[model samples]
Target: MSVIREGKVKRVLEDPESSQHVIIEFTNFVTAGDGAKKEELEGKGRLACDITEFLLQYLSDKGIETHYVETLEGPKIRCFRAAILPVEVVCRNVAAGSFCRRYGIDRGIELSEPLVEFFLKDDKLGDPLITEEAVMRLQLVNRSDIGFMKSIALSVNHYLSELFAQQNLRLVDFKLEFGRTADGRLVVADEISGDTMRIWNKEGESLDKDLFREDSGDLLSAYVGLLDILRKTDPKIIPIRSEEVHVMVMPKEGIKNPPGEVTRKGLIRLGFQDVKEVRVGKEFKIVLTRPLTSSLLKGLELMNIKLLTNPIAETHEVRLS
Candidate 1:
């Protein structure tokens, strides 16, 4: 559990057996405006975990491949490892914050469509938002990737805006991080907690950011209230029942065969109270130039590799080969 990187409210660590990625540990200490100031709030981490877990499950169920993997040790959420992009996506549904201050827009005024903005990942530079041309000129990300990321971020805001409205909350604006997975899939990677979004109650009272910005003295209370609203809205929305399993494969000739040893550790590591273990085996690797889809069954049959396993009657299960 050695710390690999520490953020304002979370620390990331490499899983001992898996050198390819790390696990994030959300902390109770919250911060804004980079590391300018920090405050300790009791139960902040738990609330973040609970809320983020719910949103991640909901979004994933709706076909969003978020970085989330599972929750371990009750409150901690496990996620698939990724290489974070050096950009922060700020999706705004209304004019507020610096937008109102700098551009003289009225607060709470909704935009016709959600505006997707990008900020260079440098807090010391005051996180100035840049245009799409500047983003590509600076080479922060590939042009195509940036386009895809913006599309996904806007879609996420649309989905969340509606979801929060159901709970009588207005989704003003939020920040999101995207990362490339081991398989090169770009997915949302950061924790979507109260710290990252500006949520307002039906009465237009602030529920998230204002508590921190204005030092409202009821920061934790506001967070708990938001959680209470969520709980009442969907108490039965438990952690997702993961059906898909992932396995890391390498060339057998050059790499030392740790299949047996890795398999044992994986079994124990993945054996959560709710998860079940299935059989494991070895097979040759198949590389596809494009994305794999359900329509590619004929191509898969030609390859002669077992790609999937029979569904087990358990909450979760994994097989490594």
Candidate 2:
């Protein structure tokens, strides 16, 4: 398809078959500090796309209108094309990030109620915070649209915060963009992923892009972890099965694994100095269509040894349940 717009981490392309939709192709580029820091991280695009698709669909199911249509191949998604508004709506629940910096307040302070803020979408001006009167004076969007966006933003925050809480994560803050379709219907646009929000685990540890921004941990690992958790929690994502195969692969004794070493050093850097060893491995859960038998169990274990793991460097265990 023909390219319509290209941003730091996404490309918008005209859909050949659908006049009402556009294809959003995600890229591997990750940025922080308002594009001051950037890196091309492999697999980041797919993770962001997957997370956004899940979240937008979740919101849509809860009666929120969004631009998401459906996921396409790889990191691309089909979405309704809309004239995106020049304003960004931010919803804050717990104090963190720029809020603390701007107001000189400590992080982790819970607000009695959700706070909605607006900012200009212009990158040149650092997206300066704009007042409600300024939004109307600038004519970015009419008063009615502003009011609707604010109301929708608060509603979205309520649902999203609860969803994250169910996953044992705190939605510290997030940004949302709205757009008007060709038919003049307003809907949520852009994306909702770790890139556009701050998520903290129960221990106040970040499971979002802040890991990459602060050089604290692995960004891809965090995204993958989040995806795994969500998948497990979403009952509709996986079908119920009578039995399944569980496989765990690990480095053989005395074998040198570079990832394990890297993880060890990373844990040490993160103040886990007491950690003596770290072994990075792989785990797989395969749903089965039939009952597990002795013959099939043996075959799976053999397959794991022959194909899934290196006999000389790694060992694997297969279990059926």
Candidate 2 C-alpha lDDT tens digits along 2-69: 99998988999999989999999999999988889999999999999999998898777666678999
Clashing pairs in 1: none
Best by TM-score: 2
Score each candidate by Cα lDDT: 0.70, 0.83
Q: What is the lDDT of residue 301 in candidate 2?
A: 66
Local distance difference test, candidate 1: 0.70
- In model 2, where is the ten-residue run with the lowest total lDDT? 235-244
200-243, model 1: which lDDT tens digit per residue?
A: 87677788856787777587888888777776665234232222
